[model samples]
Target: MSQYKINVTKLNLWYKDFQALKDINLSIKSNLITAIIGPSGCGKSTLLRTFNRMNDLIEGVRIKGEVLIDGENILDSKIDLLSLRKKVGMVFQRPNPFALSIFENIAFSLRIQGIKDKKKIETFVEKSLKSVFLWDELKDKLKSSALSLSLEQKQRLCIARTLVTMPEVILMDEPCSSLDPLATLKIEELLQYLKKDYTIVIVTHNMQQASRVSDETGFMLLGELIEFGPTKEIFTNPKDKRTEDYISGRFG
Candidate 1:
């Protein structure tokens, strides 16, 4: 197997005529957390969506170059988009669990996959919650509505839902943006455990959060990837002048 899980080469994107990404080239390591950081409109989320071709949902969007996941080019127009999305599930900035019971929220996607075995679905639900450390707290309240849970629990449950399909990669787009400091910390710790089993790519505006949980960090600005390297190197000794300036608190 290759060392990199997602390989993006010469990738470019535009919304109508407004270019959102400019020749982005990045190699995300398998089973590790990679964080994309930048100011708003710098293409952090745009770059994240490219990994799974999520940007294709928008009308008048033009894409260039390659996004290879496990040696297969996902950008190929003929590829199975549904299967690609399943393999690369995403967690949005805000927790958007369904208005259904906790159990049903996790089982909803499985139902779409035609899994009607109740007992088997229940087993996978518990396992998915356990993977995100929510099983112990939520097991007794499996029948409760997902909307009744705390913000942190909802976010964790969203993550659990993503795991239910057994995806190879999880794309998190500013997942902690709506959480409090304590809740953000919990999600950060969860990412550490999750990295053991899944490759993660996150777009975070919080520099501290990126420094805390990421193995590698990429700095993007004005639709260009300014610098990408080991987190420590990017934080302590950035080679690019713009990267150093951004990290030094001079400017975003």
Candidate 2:
């Protein structure tokens, strides 16, 4: 495996005639938490989508330069979309649990990969739910519909669904934006534990959350990365004026 779990080089993205990213060159180290922070519509989420080719689904979306995983260009035509997505998992802002049973929600990804053995699926489901700290609460309710879960529980279920695939890199797009303060703290703690095994890139509007969860932080504005470094330095003593302004809440 390469030193960087995901390496983006001179990456620029366009949606029709509107440019959303500009010369975004970033290296995300393996098994670390890197936070992408910026004001709304500053292309933070746009940059995150490029990692797993989620932007490819958007109409008229064009990308320049490369997004590499393990030294291979993921945008290459030879790449398998399904396989790539499995390696690079995504957890959306909303919980988005299927209307199916909770057990089915967690099993969805594994089933798609053609793992039909009941015993293996059972074991994997239990293990994944345990990893997300949802096993005790969800064990008795596995057969219940996912729609019945609370917002926080559903979000953890969504995380369990993502974990079932054993992805190397996980992308979180403002995951805690919809949760309460306590729930948000739980998710942050979960992220700290998760980073010990998988590389994580989170797009968060909460500067404090970024500081709390991320090892490295990138501050972006107007479709450009202004400054990126250790979380403490970027938050306390940013080299760029734009970064300092954003961090100090002078202007979002």
- Which number leads on lDDT? 1
For candidate 2, lDDT tens digit of each residue in 3-65? Answer: 688888899988999998999888889989999999999999999998888998899998898
Native-referenced Cα lDDT, model 1: 0.94
Q: In candidate 1, how many Å is residue 93 off?
A: 0.4
What TM-score would candidate 1 get against the native?
0.98
Q: List the candidate 1 regions with Cα displacement exceeding 4 Å.
A: none
How many pairs in model 1 have backbone atoms within 3 A of each other, for residues 3 or more apart or on separate chains, i.e. clashes?
0
Model 1 lDDT per residue over 1-252, tens place: 597999999999999999999999999999999999988899999988887888888999999999999999999999999889899989999899999999999999999999999899999999999999999998999999999999999999999999999999999999999999999999999999999999999999889889999999999999999999999999988999998888788887
Q: In model 2, where do residues sit more than 4 Å from their true spots?
A: none
RMSD of 1: 0.8
Q: Tell me the TM-score of each prediction against the true structure.
A: 0.98, 0.98
